[model samples]
Target: MEKCWDLNQLYLSFDDPQFSKDIKTLEKRLEDMKSIPCQDVHEDNLKSYLEQFNQFQDLVEKIYAFISLTMSSDTTNQDALKYSSVIETLLASFADTQARIDRWIGQFDLSQIQDSYIQEHMYVLQEIQENNHHLLSDEGEKVLAQMKTTGSSAWLKYKDQLISSMKVSMDGKDYPLTEVLNMAYSKDKDVRKKAYEAELAAYSQVEQGVASALNAIKGEAITVTQLRGYDSVLQRTLIDSRMSQKTLDVLLETMKKALPIFERYYRLKAEHLGYFQGLPWYELYAPVVESHESYPFEKGSQFVIEQFYSFSKHLGDYAKKAVEQHWIDIYPRVGKVGGAFCHNLHCIGESRFLLNYGNEFGDTVTLGHELGHGFHGECLNQQTALNADYPMPIAETASTFCETIIKNAALKSADSTQKLFILENELCDCAQVIVDIYSRFLFESRLIERRQKGPLSVEEIKDLMLEAQKEAYGQGLDHRYLHPYMWTWKPHYYEADYAFYNFPYAFGLLLAKGLYALYQQQGPSFSEIYEKFLSLTGQMSLEDVGKSVGIDLQDAHFWQNSIDMIKDDIDLFEELLKQNS
Candidate 1:
């Protein structure tokens, strides 16, 4: 297998004639669209303007997908980084462009767009109005947007540079931070312990700078949220994510009840690792199985596709196309970034996945995971451009739902040991999304409230973190083992643009589980409803989408029921652990 992605479908080079032509045409379209008079447009003009918007969106998507996917594959590639910078510069004026659209749409009285035919577009119009409050004066918004390149974002880039280049001493040999962090997967216990120490020590080199970056980024978000009249940072996110706070409240409460279950699992693992009192942070991702086997790329790909198809032919077909059609870029090679991500390239009517494929069982799940995202995007292909971008809460619905399918199918088909490994991975990921993510939400919410008083010292931040962990995790984590520096390394905190990014993970997981539960009841025929739900997610409120499938996200019991499903897994895992012992 070639085991790499080819980018020639986009262009051989940015300097290529076709690439230059597309770039010029894109700039020309933006200018052309700006010249069109908005006041003279009636319903027909509004329709025409929206169509042109779709075309512009398509052009920009192709240009961007090419560069971003390339950059992720090789972060150090100078040309890729240059293209990344160029894309940023172009998108910097996004506020200006968006403000123009907002003003144009605002010109139309709601009655004009509320007809039965345009009802589907109500969400799009509502989103614009919701965002309009954040738009400053044209010049002001543009300048502030442009400054982002060298503002908190620049500090973020600096933090990454400092961390990546920093060296750590491990077993008398110094290594880069990336290499040191990978030691968690080592089969040797002593090596894992040493790697943990080395990784922690490496953070010291860039702690202050990263912390300052965090302060600036988070501070900027708080200031802007206040200026925009959002109740809080999380409130702003709820609006952007098309989710309700009530929904979040229910899900958070459910996680609160499930914390002890995850804690029990953690303690069992600790005993296995020969720790009596507390499991150290290094062992958080430690694998317990002794006879580990690696899956080469081919077997891994086949396994994922076969398992997914076993659950649902629609899902299996999409995964197969994703692999066969060059939509996936798999394999661990030099120059690729460390984690995995999927880009739903809506413009090209497809997606691209990037993973540092480590040949672990987890990697198989990851393929199913990213392809699930791609399939979700595929469902949205029927929608208009403006209507196809779903909010964060609903974003993970398909991905997690597909993951559920693979896990359930694997449990049915695998031997006892394989079932244990699969369940462990499922439990591990669920714990992070449910328990760990809740703690992050707690930490960030408190940080925002305290930050309103002004800049917090490092000590104040640590105290806030400690309080948050205690509140969210309860007796689950050994109080001593709770991580304090969590705010420092997690990239979600620095995405100043997207606040309260934590809750959506839980929202996505629980919501996906709820959807999967429905699938179990409805059988294969539920595929039609599932596709409809996915297609509408980009255009409907989270609440509205749930109603399509007889779900009410606002109700606490709906969430409680979904979470209880996970409790079943925990009970089974416990029984198996005890049985094995």
Candidate 2:
């Protein structure tokens, strides 16, 4: 099987004739859209406008996704970078166009629309109307959009460049930052320690630039959110997430209650690592019981396929097709980014995944997580481009649910040591999504609050990061070993548009767990319900989506149930550790 994904399905290369043709076609479409005379909201006017606009959107998605996926796989691809810039500029120029449509749509009492196509898109229409309240005047929106090209957008680009170019010096040799960061998973204590130190040292080269980027991007966000009349950045994020404060309040409260359990797991991990105080940050990712099992690419594929098949034939077949059809770009190369992500191209109805595969068992699980994202795209293929766009929180649901399937299946037949290893891996992830994510949430809240006054010094950013870590990790981590340069590397905090990108991870994991609980009770019959949920993710509010599956997202009891599931795993891990010891 091919190790690299084929983007030929999108275009043979950036120089493809169709690629250029699409750019021209997109320009024409934008011009045509601009020429469409604005009329009073009537069934015909609305339907005609939406039909043309949705088609425009689909083409734009295809063009942008092609450029983005190309850059993600090879960041130094000059053509990809150039085209991405072109597309961003074009889209920024359209901000006023979009705002005008939004304002027009806002004028209509959407409930009065009787057209079938309009009825089909009621949710999208309603969302546009809702967001119209927050939009500025045409000139104002255009100015903001143009300024952002240099402001947050440029800063994000700079941050990516800094990280991509960063190299760590270890033992008189240079290693890429991604390779050194991956050493965190190494079983060799010396390697992990040295890598951690080198990693920290490398940050000095880009720390000030990154801090400035953070300050500028967040300051921009604060300015814009207030200009848009949002009470705070978090409130804007919640509105964008289509989630209410009540739901967030309950989820966070439940997470607070469950924090100490993860703390206990952290302490247990510290004990396993032979640390008397707490697990040192360097050893946080250290494997508890080493498993000799290595899953090479083919072996990993087979394992993921088998586990996915056990869930249902449809899911199993989807996994098989994704691998056989060159849907995945597997393995890391120089200049390729670290970590894994699945980008779904709705226009062409295919998803491309980027993975930095090492022959670790966790890599196999990562495959499952990303393919779960692919499966989500598959379920939404039948929907329109606008309707297929799900909110941040629900975005991770299918991926995490698929991850649960793989991990649970792994644990079923494992020996004592393997069980302990698997459980530790699972608990390790949960702790991050639960406890560490809470730290990020706290840190971001404080960062935004502080960024308002003025640009913070590097020391101030590091101090805030450390303070947040102390509060969230509590005594779970040795105070002396906390990572301060974390704010420099994570891309989440740098996005002015997508602020507070941390908590959605927690929300996604917990919601997936809750869904998994339902699957346990309902069994194979749950597959239909699961697919339905995935399909509606783009159309429904998160609360309504949960209600579709009889879940009450605002109920603390529901979130506590998800936490209880993790606690059970922690309990098993402790028992297994004791028995093995």
Candidate 3:
């Protein structure tokens, strides 16, 4: 009912007495955890430790989520920033404690035991044990953890500031970077081109600072991974992501094969824009068929509810409840972060979404996407806190699947022009998640490889970005107009822990597409099984989770089927272009 999300359910404000009480409780619990006779290994000790650890985890997540979510909505909020810093330091200390517990647990063979709690928490404990080989010495981990606050964490804060505060100059006027970026979707060609140019020019002011932050952040990731004995940053990320190299190898290989299809779509878009050579980077987001279809917030919610109900009453109910309960922070304002995300608070059995809504068709799809994530949270809410944490790649599955449901439903009801517009929008999304993401993966791989030697110069970073774009986009984009400073603004690149955040998007998109295709064949019964699949995400490996649903994540054929689905859309888009022309 309200425009902003109700964090009051979590906490009224930072100044809330409860917030302070929890901070003290968390600190005291950290001390209590440290004092646990963890070295004294036995069933009782393990059981007691597990119970205390669960409480500690829930408390810390509640406290930290409140602060982080607050900061995301208001980047300049001093109270949020202060609490965020405090929690970061506390969590770092907490990580050291967790590391020690992990080591102690690793020395035991608790997996052989049949305790109910152990059975319930088998995956969580086993993962810690499996990663014990990579765990640094307690002292080493503590030092690394402390260093990160000043290193990658600080860099992340700095980069967030640079982008949030950045003002793009256009035609002797200034606009927020987000406002300028939104112009790329404008129907006016000059507005898109000018916005692109202004965005590039604006980056010059913060390029040096952003470049330094990236170097520092990535440099720390490289150093920490090496200290932990990881084979590489990517390998470390895959391990943390709970994905296997075999699965990544297959997913990437499929994506590589599908590049030409996306390129064909891009070139067709270019030709439609009257650029025979290729689509200029600026025009990549330009709407192909201008539809005046706009869904205001209320209409958007109703439409999503209807479409989701067509798929499953459960999903429809969740969408209706999220809207009615004020779980979403809709619309954009100064200092709020760009993009959209659903933060699922399993600790509270609730989810909060942030959106930069602009009353466009894409905005409705984004609402579907984020709510899909919330629906995922609803599924996982039934699990204990320890088992509710799904890996990054599988994390995208439900969200993207929800988007597909709504998009397909809309396409079915639209006229020819609106259908063309919707299909083109879908293809554009698939292109980014699949094609552009490939370039980002390449860039990060090379950047990490080279970052091992030393920090990269700004010029070298730009060069790497261009080289990756050229390879991934090929002639789909006019080489001359490619974004060189792409690495600077994308928050994914600056994340120290999640090295290759790029490909997981492609993984989620393709995997969800495959799931959607399965839904098409199986019809209504598929919805029940789909929720079951989401529930297991927190408990199983990506491949095993796919196996549960009769999908082979490691098989090229499985991914290709999803790619072929996109290819069909691309074909339809091209045909639509001709019909419209």
> lDDT of all predictions, in order shown?
0.78, 0.90, 0.89
TM-score of 2: 0.96
Q: What local lDDT score does residue 41 receive in model 3, on the 0 to 100 scale?
A: 75
Q: What would the per-residue lDDT of candidate 3 be over residues 101-217, giving only the tens digit for each residue? A: 888898778756767987788888889888999988888888877777778988999998999899898999989887888799999999999999999989989999999999998
Clashing pairs in 1: none
The residue pairs in collision within model 3 are none
User: Which prediction has the highest TM-score against the true structure?
Assistant: 2
How would you order the candidates by TM-score, starting with the best? 2, 3, 1
**lDDT for model 1:** 0.78
Candidate ranking (lDDT, best to worst): 2, 3, 1
State the TM-score for model 3.
0.96
Candidate 1 Cα RMSD (Å): 2.1
Model 2 lDDT tens row, 219-290: 999999999998999999998999998999898888888888988999998897789798889998998888
The C-alpha stretches of model 3 lying farther than 4 A from their native spots are 15-17, 74-76, 165-167, 333-336
Expressed as tens digits, the lDDT of each residue in 435-508 for candidate 1 is 78978888888888887788787777878888887776665555776666677767788887798888888888
